[model samples]
Target chain A: MSNNTAIKIENLSKMYRLGQIGTGSLGQDLNRFYAKLRGKEDPYSIIGQTNDRTSEAESDFVWALKGINFEVKQGEVLGVIGKNGAGKSTLLKLISQITAPTTGAIKAKGRIASLLEVGTGMHPEMTARENIFLNGAILGMTKKEIKAKFDEIIDFAGCQMYIETPIKRFSSGMRVRLGFAVAAFLEPEILIVDEVLAVGDAEFQKKAIGKMKEVSNGGERTVLFVSHNMGSIKTLCNRAIVLEHGKLVYDGTAEDGVSYYLNNQNNASEKNLLQRTDRIGNGKLKFTGIKMLNKKNKSVNEIIAGDPVKFNIDYKTNCDIDVNKLLFGITFWDQHENKILGYSTDEMGITFSNLKNEGYFTLNIPCFGLRGGTYNIKLIATVGGTKMENMLDNIENAYSMTVLPGDFWQTGKANRSGNMALLKGSISQHNE
Target chain B: MNKDEDWDIILKPKRNLLDINLKQIYQYRDLLFLFVKRDIITTYKQTILGPIWFFVQPILTMVIYVFIFGKVAKISTDDIPQPLFYISGIIMWNYFSSCFSLTANTFTGNAGIFGKVFFPRLIVPLSQITSNLIKFCIQFILFLIVFFYYLNSNAITPSYLIVLLPVLILIIAVLGLGLGLIFSSLTTKYKDLKFLMQFGIQLLMYATPVIYPLSTIPAQYQFWFKLNPLTHVIETFKTAFLGSGQFSLTGLLYSCIFTTFTLIIGVIIFNKTEQNFMDTV
Candidate 1:
């Protein structure tokens, strides 16, 4: 570990046993004890090893993170972006000392405070004033320092009415605001933040992101931020680390990392669509295939956000049905799993008539008015209030579209917070 | 920047198998003081009787013990007045029992906060111990009032051993904290232990010298009685406050050793458990 390097992780690995549930057997425990007694490395540290005596299992362990090697320089803000369950949270937990890695050593230079969940130490029974001190203590802040920053924290949180009120009485937003304020004021040498910024409303989120930017710019502190929000990651992080299935797939510039993440989602549509049963809901109903074609009937993976788009769903309803409601819903969710907009056939008054058996349905929309981002389509067929077919295909990313820069309202902005953009009409005033 | 200096404090990380950092704990002493204050203030904040409940609880427990053990069972109060005898033991035992029960559920009770951040996880238990100590001090004052009133009423004379009261209280605190941490760590894995902890403290009070004097038990059971370190602690507390009670330097020495050993082991296990206890907990 070099002094300039804020964090140095050497061949770090974490493996979790699948179903040999509970702690391992007494024999295995004794074996481990003996191994340690003899100064031998843990035998079970081998990847995919199982020590179950009765069962000759193929593989009993899943590596949450495997052989992750990286060096973070002092004062660098490194963004970690990955798909859900890609071991992002696990890595943060390991570094924050919340959990120990199964193997490897992680060495860091200074005091580390992880705002994995803001206000983590806030007690509902305690007043905001009391909880601030409690939260500060939990974040490793001395009492004197917390006292000095108390007024500033309350001002930043923007909650003045009930500092003495129990946190249980505070609204969810207030709690999050206070929590974030305490964490933001901590000023630890190293700050590890998970996707906690998604907790508050748009205004608070903007404030939080601004605070994060300020903290990173302080020049002596290092930050490891993990978020699926590409726009925020792009704006704040100088470098990015991308993980795929516990592997460090990409590590370099933030732009390349975002593009790499987007490209991975793009390629997923091909191989992932064929494995439709696994991708969609529990195998209650199976979507055999989904295809998007243009007016020329050629397969197109990308589309303009406001352009005419056609969706064809080939699904098999396994059960006999009556009063079946074939619900075709398109959910436009951002990379961070925030639902931007969702439209269903029922919501649109475009429900299909009676269908006797399982077959294919071709749904066409004249104009899909979504901003540029990856969207998912969920196809469901229910009979008599019982769902017979429900399929969610993320491989196609449902629909990958790009809304180009235009005179469109808020075109230059990265995030379109509003549900929809209305066409503008200007009135000229002639004054004497 | 030299890498050696960067990772200096962490590399050979203090073998704090007893991961409780006394220095770091001292650093957060204000937080601990506030937590104690919070517990005491909140306990009586909206109560009709307010701080009077502190006096009421032990006085009431002493009355019941005097009735059952003193009058009915014909048990000796070690020549001390029965109320003073029972109240002294009750105050000390109340502190231990409350501290033990509270500390035992530390992780389960604070799971929300524990999962959210990383602190010297020992802070919760330390704060709990300190807070219970404050409550103990309040009740001890009440006990002193009762002691002085009895003395003025020509009932009993206070002993010089009363000077040992602080040492006796310290022993009880350490013993309770040690046992509490051990049980709290175990409870994270075995939830059934929580149910036992609730009832276990009350049951263990019978085994200790809480209601009856140490001489009441048969000589054959004396070894078993001594096995419970708390029996020695309670006996010594009574010996220190009430004039006529017995004091065994040997017993106090045994308890001090037991408390130290248990505390060391508790810290070691607690340190290890806090690292990844969240997974199982």
Candidate 2:
């Protein structure tokens, strides 16, 4: 580990046991111990599959990560991107030494601090001033070092008024401010942050992003950032890696890596939305097919703002049932799992109370107004009743859509702000 | 020791079964202090009685024991005043029990912090030991006050072996910490061990001669009770502080060896379990 290489991982893999303490718990461990004495391969390790959240698990063993190999150089910022359960967090966990890998090794130099989540180790009962020292020490800072930066941390967190008050009395926003302040100011040789910007309000997110950029560009220590926000990744990271199903799919410059991950990854899984076992609903009705199309009815991965995008939901009913109150709805959620907008058949006063068979429903937005980012589509099919079995189908994260930047205003300028949604507005020129 | 920066710490497919990395623990000493401070501070916050609760627990338990065991059960204290003898026993027994249970819950209780960050992991149990030590020190002062009163009244005599006060305390602390670490590590894999821990410590107190003198257990059963490592520590504590109980030099030596062995085995099992206990816990 020279000064040039900050972290080096080779053949790193993590296997997780499914269920709790019944089968393949201690018995398999003893068996593995006996086999190792005879110089044989681990009997339990041979049956693990890659970490995929969808699909039925075959055995009690699953590989949360496998065959992972990467090297991060000193003073370089690396971004890790992957779909949910693609082993992004697991990889960071291994690198941070929170949990040891099952079958490989990770070697790194200097002190490493990981901010896996906001307010990670902050004690709720301690005062803000005291918690600063505790969180700093947790990240490997000495008492004298934290004292030197005490004023700076207090000023940065902007909790000067309540320094002596316990943090449980502070609002959640104030707590995040203090937590992020301590984490960013610890000044370790290596920093690992996972979705930290997802916390706090919009203004705080902007400030946190700016601080992250300055920290990554300091040219003194390395940084590893993991987030679902493509914009931040492109702006802050110099290099990036895309992981799919616990395997490294792409590794390159930040721009190309994000582009490849967004464009090509998860295409097959997205196409087979209904086959995924992650959904819950009655077996009477289920989603059969779903697709997104451009104005020309051509299938596309993304659509520009102000364009007419079409969503078609194909359905199949198992038996003839209540058609008078049947409902087909689609909800849009941003990458952060925040619900953006929703549209439903019942809410629109459209009655599907007629006889139905295998058919499809089309929902067309006049302009398809949504911000330029990937959004998750949740399919909600139900009957109008409060009964326990009224739900026909509720498949969350069934499909995804990507909206691109467009000049909706026709002013020869695009929307440069990071607003959550786009709108088509009419303006009348008038002097007040 | 190899100083090549190529691998400051190499994590392999399988860890050495008994590698208690003392250097790593030393490196994270700052974290240990911080955790100890957190444990001490956060425990008393928001309560009206505050830290008074720490003193109240053992003092109140001693008063009840004096009333029930000394007055009701007619147990022998070897002719010494009842409260003085019972208070000393309660103080020592309380420290060991609190330290044992607190450190034993290390893996299960702090799984949130342990899952998100990585340090030496030993810092948690070490902090538990130190924080409980602070509590024990405060309670010990109370015991000293009672002892001074009994001495002025000529109710008891002090032994020359009172010089071994620190040794007796050290052995009990180590025994508690060691047993706590072992239970904590094992419970992560088999949660049923936790239930046993809850009741076992209570039963173990009776077996250790905390409420009664060892001489009262009858000569036939004396050797059986002496087999408990804690029996020697508490017996020695009473004999040294008040000069009223048996003080066998060989029993103390046996306890010294047993405490060392438990601590060593405890640390090895703890270090091994901390690596992957998160997956199971």
Candidate 3:
């Protein structure tokens, strides 16, 4: 590893056995122990050797993270972007020494502190003052050092009045603020943050991002940040790593990685629509597939800020069911679980008369004025007030679709205020 | 990389083993002191009696033992006054029991904090032991009051063995901590062990000669009594203060050897468990 490289991860892989859960048995423990003692590779190393699909899929290990290699230099701020279950948290946990990696090695320099979650080490009965020290100790800070910085931490958290009050009395925001304040002030050589900034308000978030920038710019520390906000990723990160299905899909400049992630998200939604049955659910009545197309009947993942789009849902009913009283609704939620828009057949004044066989339905809406961002479409099918199938289908990132710069609104800013863009109109003044 | 500039002191945790960094632990000693202070201060902050609970608990337990075992059961205190004898045993026993009980639940109790941060896990149990020692100190003073009152009345005389009180207390603390850690590690995997721990500690007090004098046990049962390391610790305490119980140097040696051995094993198991206990716990 180069001297400038703050972190070096080599062939890092993490495999968790599928269905062979509960920390494994004593026999399996001994088997693994003896295998390590004999210098043999993990008995479960052979990826597909234990694959037995018929017998409840035994003897197979799921690679939560696979053969990942990367280097982070001093003062570098790297963003780790991945979908849920993509092993982002696992990677941080391994680096922070919360858990050991099952395979490979990670070499890192400096005192590393990770804010994996907020209010992690806070004791409810302990006062804010006591918890500050307790939390400092848990983060590996010495008492003398914490004492030296105590006033600063309390001031930053803005909870000095309640220093002697138990933390249980603090609001969630206060708890998060205090937690972030401590972690940020720890001043470690390397900091790893995992989506914890999303906990606080926008003002605190801006402050935290600013602090992260300061920490990295100081030229002595490095940072690894993970967030789903592409805008923040683009603004905060110098480099970025993209993970897809437990694999390193891309690693490069922040712009390129963000673009790659957006493009991959586009493809994933398309692929998931094609293979919708594989999505986990009751599996009795299923949303077999879904497709969104433009007026030209072309399958388009991208659309203008205001344009016409058509949604087609292909579903199968296990048994004959009533169609007249059936309800088909679709809700669009942003990546952060923010609901942007929703519509149902009842609200649209469209209803099916009678249906006995499995089929497809198409809903078309014109002049959809959704702003640029990724949005998930949740399709719910209910009959006789009993819900059957509900699936959140990804329709390209609605918001991330590029909007040309010169319309009525200025395009220099990356994000526009409010929920969605509104048509702009102006009344002209005439002088005679 | 310049080796001299690099401050990489943390070692990767050894697999399938409990590893401790004594140096890093020492480096964080100030944090430990703060944690101990936090424990002591926050424990009494909202309570009515506050620090007096520390004194009241042992005194009340000694009074109850005096009522049930001395007056009701007519158990002999080996010709020693009931209050002084019971107070001595109660103080020492309460300290050991509290240490073991608290240490046994260390991992479970602190899982929330442990899951979030990376620190020497040993600091938690160490702080608990230290904090409990504060309580023990208060109760020990109360025990001293009873001892002096009896001495002033010419009812009992302390022996030269009283010099061994501190050493005996150290042995008892280590024994409690060791066994507590072992049980705590086990409880992470089997939650049922926690229930057993509460009942088991109470049952162990009966086996240890806390309420009854060691001399009261029949001669044939002496070997079995000696098998209990805590028995020797209690007997040593009684002999040191009340000056009536038997004091065998060989028994003290045996207890010391057992305490050391249990502690070593406890440290090993505890180190191993701390690594991935977050998962199981």
Candidate 4:
């Protein structure tokens, strides 16, 4: 290991047993023990399957993390991007020493602090001042050091008046504020944060992201951030990796890793909607395929801010049900997961009485009034007419489109970027 | 890369079961102090009696023991006044039991914090031992008040072995800590062990010479009673305090050996369990 390498992990793997914990697990543990005593390979290693949390694991043991190899340089902010159950958290847990890996070693140059979850050791019955000490202790800081940083942490968290009060009385946002404040001030040589920023409100998230940026840039500290949110990853991380099924499949710059992750969504659409794993619905009826269509009805991956477009939602109802109470809708979100537009069949006051068990619905837009950005579409289906009782289906990020500026008004151009909605109006001035 | 000879720390899987890593404990001494404060302060928070409950518990237990053992059960305290003798035994036993039960819940109770952060996990068990000592001291004041009253009345004579009070307390502590460590590790995977421990610990009080002197035991049951290591510590404690009851170096040595071996085994098992208890717990 060179001096510039802040952290080095080699062949790290963790296997977790299934079914009743600690009962049958003791047998497996003993097996490994006797195997090691005989200088043989790990006995359970052959039966371990890759971690795929969304599916029913095929074996009695699953490798939560397997064959992970990586090296982080000094002052590097590495983003870890993965879908649910992709072993991102497992990697962080191993490196943080929250648990031991079944195999391999991790060597680092300096202290490592992990904010795996905010307010990790914070006691609800203890005062915030005291919890600061507790949290600091868990983060491997001395009481003297916490005392020195006391005022700064409080001022940063903006909970000075309630510092003496028990943390149970504080709102969740305040708890996260104080939690992040303590973590940011530690200034450890390596910081590992795992999806904790999502707990805070928007303003606190921004502040936390900025603080993380400072931690990586100012003190020559390496950081590993695991988040499903690609936008923040792009904003703060210089390099990134993509993990899928307990394997490091892609390693590159942050921009490339994000693109690689987002591009995987294309394969889901190719597999058809009913087969997609990342969805929840009653399955009474389902969307077969959804695509963005241009004015000429040609499917396009990218659309413009202005000009006409339509969403062709092809549906095939499997079982017989009342078609009149059914409603179709789509919600669009900008790059930052902010809702930009929501359109529904109810808004148009149209209920088709002649709908069949197998057909398609085309949502036509006279003018696509969205500013320049990448927007994702969520498909929704509801039943029970105006009562809207049953939510038959709701798929998030089902289809994504990149919108650019186009000629809308007589000014010959539309907006360039960063606006949620576009409006159309003409101001008529007379004797001004 | 060549085992990283230049690195500061290398984290690997446990190679030995007895890697207690006392240096790590020494490095995190401040955490131990903070946890001690947390336990002591939080124990009384939001309660009406607050710190007074600390004194009331042993006093009330002593009163009940006096009524049952001294009056009704007709157990002899070796001619020592009933209240003073019962109070001393109750405080000592209370300290040991408290240490055991508190540390027994260490892994399961702190699983939330343990899952999220990494520190010297032993700090939790050690802090339990220390915090229970604080409660022991508070109740010791009650034992002292009764001791002084009986001393003025010429009921008993204080032995020179009274100076060995710290040693007796240390043995009791180590015994409690050892048993607690063993139970905590077991209860992580065998959650039913916690409930069993509660019932088992309560029954164990009768086995030790707490309310009655070992001399009260019949000749047939003396060997079995001596088999309980706490019997020695408690008998020696009474002999050291009131200048009565049996006192022998061999018995004390047996207790010491039992305590040391139990503690070593407890620590080894505890260190092993802590590494991955988050998974099973």
Candidate 5:
């Protein structure tokens, strides 16, 4: 470890037992004890698979994190990006010492405070003032430290009138603001944050990001931030690392990391969509497959921004009850999870009645309006005319597509880096 | 990494089984104080009676014990007034019981906070012990009121061993904390132990001489009763305040030794369990 190295992680790994703990642990413990007595390795430790939630367990143990090595320099803002089960949180938990790793070690300089969540120990019945102290103390701040920054925290949270009100009475936005304010002032040498900004209103999120930027720019503190919001990662992080299947697959600049993560999502569509477990619905109707087609109706992975394209969504009705008022929708979202464009059958007053058990719906667009960027598609099907009460299916990121830049306004120059969508319009100059 | 490196903290896969990290615990003393204050302040919040519940629980238990054991069972109260006798034992027993039960759920109860934050996990159970001590002090005042009431009637005499009041409280606390720590660590692994613990404290109380004097027990059964460390502490409490119950030096010494052993074993197991209880809990 060097003086400039704020955190040095070496060969860190964590293995978690699957299924029920303690049910068959006694035998495993005995096996481990026997192995240790015979001067051999633990029997169960050697047999395990990677952390993949969608797969069936072939063994009783899985390595949540495996042989991870990374170094964070002082005053560096490192962003960690990964899929849902890619061991990002496991890595943070290890660095924060919430749980000990199964193997390897981490050497850290100065105090390390992790905001795996804000208001971790806050009581709902306590006033905001009281909870601030409690939350600060839980985040490793002394009472004197909290008292010194009490006015600043209240000012930042902007809940001066509600300081004496119990947090239960405050709006959730206010609560998150209060929690984030307390955490922002923690002033630990190494701060680990995990998606805490996913909550709170937009204004508070901007303030929090600004606070985080300020904290890292102090030239003495280091920060490790994890979020699914690619926009924040690109804006707030100087460097980023991408984890895939419990392994560090990419370590580079934030822009490159975001692009690497977005590009990696393209391969996930190769799996049969029907077998996807990451969907939300009542299971009345399910999306089985999605095909992106160019103007000639030939299936293509990449679509030009100004070109005509079509999306064919294959679905199957689980039961025979669906008849009329079917609302089928497809939404396009950027890598930052911002909804870019949405098209629904009801928008054109088109309804499919008495749908077949297994059929496909095609949405044709004369001009695809998305800019040149990778986007994800979410498929939604509802029975009750665009109302969410009878939502049959909602699958987020069911399909990933890359759009190439094109002249949408018939101009020779391609319009890039303006916004997510391009609008078709003609402006006439007035002789004023 | 070289040993000469000036890293402030080195997190490792396995620490010594007995590593309790007293320095870390000391560093987070403010958190412990906050936890204790939270428990004390929030437990009775929004209630009409507030901290009055502290006085009500023990007094109600004393009244019931006086009726059941004093009048119905005809068990001797060591010739001390029934209310005076039972209240003293009740206050002492209440402190230990509340502390034991509360600390026993340290791992399972605070899993949310423990999962998110890194601090000395021992601070939680220690806070429970401290908060319960505050409650015990409040109830002791009620006991003293009853003691003086009996004193004016000249019905009982107080002993100079009364100075052992603080020592008696310390014994009860250590015994409760030790056993609670042991059970808390075990309950994280085997959740069924939690159900046993709920009724286990009740069963253990009968084995101690809480409602009756040690003299009421037969000679053959005295050894088993004496084996319970609480037996000596409650007996000494009653002997000091009421001047009627027995307080042998050997019994007190035996209780202290038992408490020390339990605490050492409890801390060892607790420190070991806190390392990875989040994974299982």
Candidate 6:
């Protein structure tokens, strides 16, 4: 309610009905009607659980978002970070009015345009020129406004030659660029962009981040951005909020928010990894536990970039089958779910023939080459050299490890703001 | 609470059922215009005949009606030329049916767009009605050409009541739009209505005086036809242009009242549905 505040959300919650969904029983409709007739609240909505996807529903309803409250100042670029199904998108959808909340309200200043997707409402049969107008109008731009900036949008997208051509013929990257170009020209006071940059190529992503900065840096526009990419969040957002299980868990500077999310979040690491039922495969061999160890082999989940580390994956075999050419692999994915580093015992031509019923695979690295960030570790155990490589166990997002910035090259300075991988090489001056 | 008044927008869990945002729809008039343009243009994108299909469609339907209902069934055309009588009814009924069916699919058909963006949801159905009107006008020209041919032979006479043509069209549009909105809202939750809508429109067409003149029906059943708002529209349209068929001020007045109520109720349900239809859809 202050003069500088652009948006204020008060205890906003969205409850969704689970199981036997959308069939819309007449009995329930009548129940809801009777409740309303008695001047009472919705009967089914009053009792529900939190928005946790990992657990079975205790009731027929689940709160997709619950008791979420935050305030964004004008000209502030706020990044919303959370794991999938953690209410990040539900919050954005609520703020953008794509769907209404079940309880509470959001009061905001000025016009709000959300790019929950790029080229939303664009017709494939329409020419690029036509889609620009259509997409622009869908994003709340007038025809005259689109016409005035038509050339700029085309130039920005770098598709002037294909402006007359239908966009269906364009490559996926070209379509993204064209869509982002029109959206960028929309000068709404508040902009909600939800992971639209994940589709475009690298150069276009850079241009999009720059445009977003320019829009917010003008001291007039407010932006709410949601993405799985933490690098963009740290660079583009001045402040950030983290939602976990539909609750506002962290709110502060973008740096602290990203660290808080990475440090406190892990899928099966907190509980006994052996008890996790989300794993998939033939289950002939199952991963019992995965641990990140320091040089002394002590368990540690956080390490510096240049530190020596080992990934110890404990497994147990189910049957007495002879294990021939068994492979143990561990893949490290960055925050964006891009595979940054992966190593398999078979890659080094060192395959075990007969594995014990219970054993552990240790992948040792003399120097951890990944830059400072959180990486998810996926464990896969397979038996090769016999009848088309049988996968025994595959556990995705089994563990999350935090990598701190360090002197990977021993240069006393850190390599930041670049690719996620680090390398060390020797250079000597030579006269040629 | 007073301080909250300054905010540009306030989103709440429940809004007034009657809180139809006409101002917002007006503000997004350009979107409506573009949607109308998109519907009309993309419909004939790769078709060979293009807009000529607009003419071919009604002409074909007229010929069929003339064959089945006129020659085979012996349905009366009130002594007017078979083509003119049927064409007049065909054009008017086509406009109503197209408006109803197209607008009825507004929520389900545009779910992809509706889910991603936030605009006045009313603009979509408004655009459907608008674009169908454009198609109707093109088909109306076809009707006029046939009307001129009949007029030269003294088979038909134009009345001053022809001035009410715009009013009659307005009633048909409102009736279709209203019922379409109501059905569209229902289809989002109960998909069974979608199937019902397909055959329901066909059956409703028979209940109105489309293939046969109002005189062909007995007086007892004619009252039931009058209960259908479209019957008055079709009757008034025929009486004004073709110089035969029933046209009553009271009947037109009854349609006006019926259309106004349907529109109000349709908008109420539509406004309610658009808010959270995405969740169900």
User: Candidate 2 residues A88-113, lDDT tens each?
Assistant: 99888888888889977887778888
Off by over 4 Å in 3: A17-24, A30-61, A266-268, A271-418, A422-432, B1-18
Error of 1 at B170 (Å): 1.0
Docking class of 3: acceptable
For residues A34-127, write the lDDT of model 3, one tens digit per residue.
9999998767667632222223543457666878898899899999998777778878888888766656777778788888885676778888
lDDT of 2 by residue, B1-281 (tens): 22445656566766886787788788778888888888888898889999898889877888898899999998988898888988899889988998899889999999998888888887887888898889889889899999999899888888888999889888988998999999999999888899999899999988989989998998999989999998988888888888889899999999999999999889889978888888888
The candidates' DockQ values read 0.30, 0.34, 0.31, 0.51, 0.51, 0.55
lDDT of each: 0.73, 0.83, 0.75, 0.83, 0.85, 0.86
Candidate 1 off by > 4 Å: A1-3, A19-31, A34-44, A47-58, A265-268, A271-369, A372-413, A417-432, B8-20
Tens-place lDDT per residue, model 5, A363-400, is: 89999887777888899988776556688888988888
Q: What's the C-alpha lDDT at position A368 in model 5?
A: 82
- B2-32: candidate 1 lDDT, tens digit per residue: 5445572242212357455677667667767
Q: Which candidate, 1 or 5, has the higher TM-score? A: 5
- Top-DockQ structure, candidate number: 6
Models 1 onward score TM values of: 0.79, 0.82, 0.79, 0.82, 0.81, 0.84
Find the 10 residues in a row with the least total lDDT in model 3 chain B: B4-13
Please write out the lDDT profile of model 6 over residues B1-281, one tens digit for every residue: 42978889999988898998788888899999999999999999989999999999899989998899989998889898999989998889888998899889989998998889999999988998999999999999999999999899999887888999999989989899999999999998889999999999999989999989899999888888889988888988898998898899999999999999999999999989988999888
lDDT winner between candidates 4 and 5: 5
> What TM-score quantifies how close candidate 3 is to the native fold?
0.79
Instruction: Please state the error at residue A37 of candidate 4 in Å.
Output: 5.6
Candidate 6 lDDT, A334-361, residue by residue in tens: 8788998888877777757656789888
TM-score, model 2 to reference: 0.82
Each prediction's Cα RMSD?
Answer: 8.7, 8.4, 8.6, 8.1, 9.1, 7.1
Counting only residues 3 or more apart in sequence or on different chains, how many pairs clash (N, Cα, C under 3 Å) in candidate 5? 0
Provide the global lDDT of candidate 4 against the true structure. 0.83
Alpha-carbon runs more than 4 Å astray in model 2: A1-3, A22-24, A268-370, A373-400, A404-432, B1-4
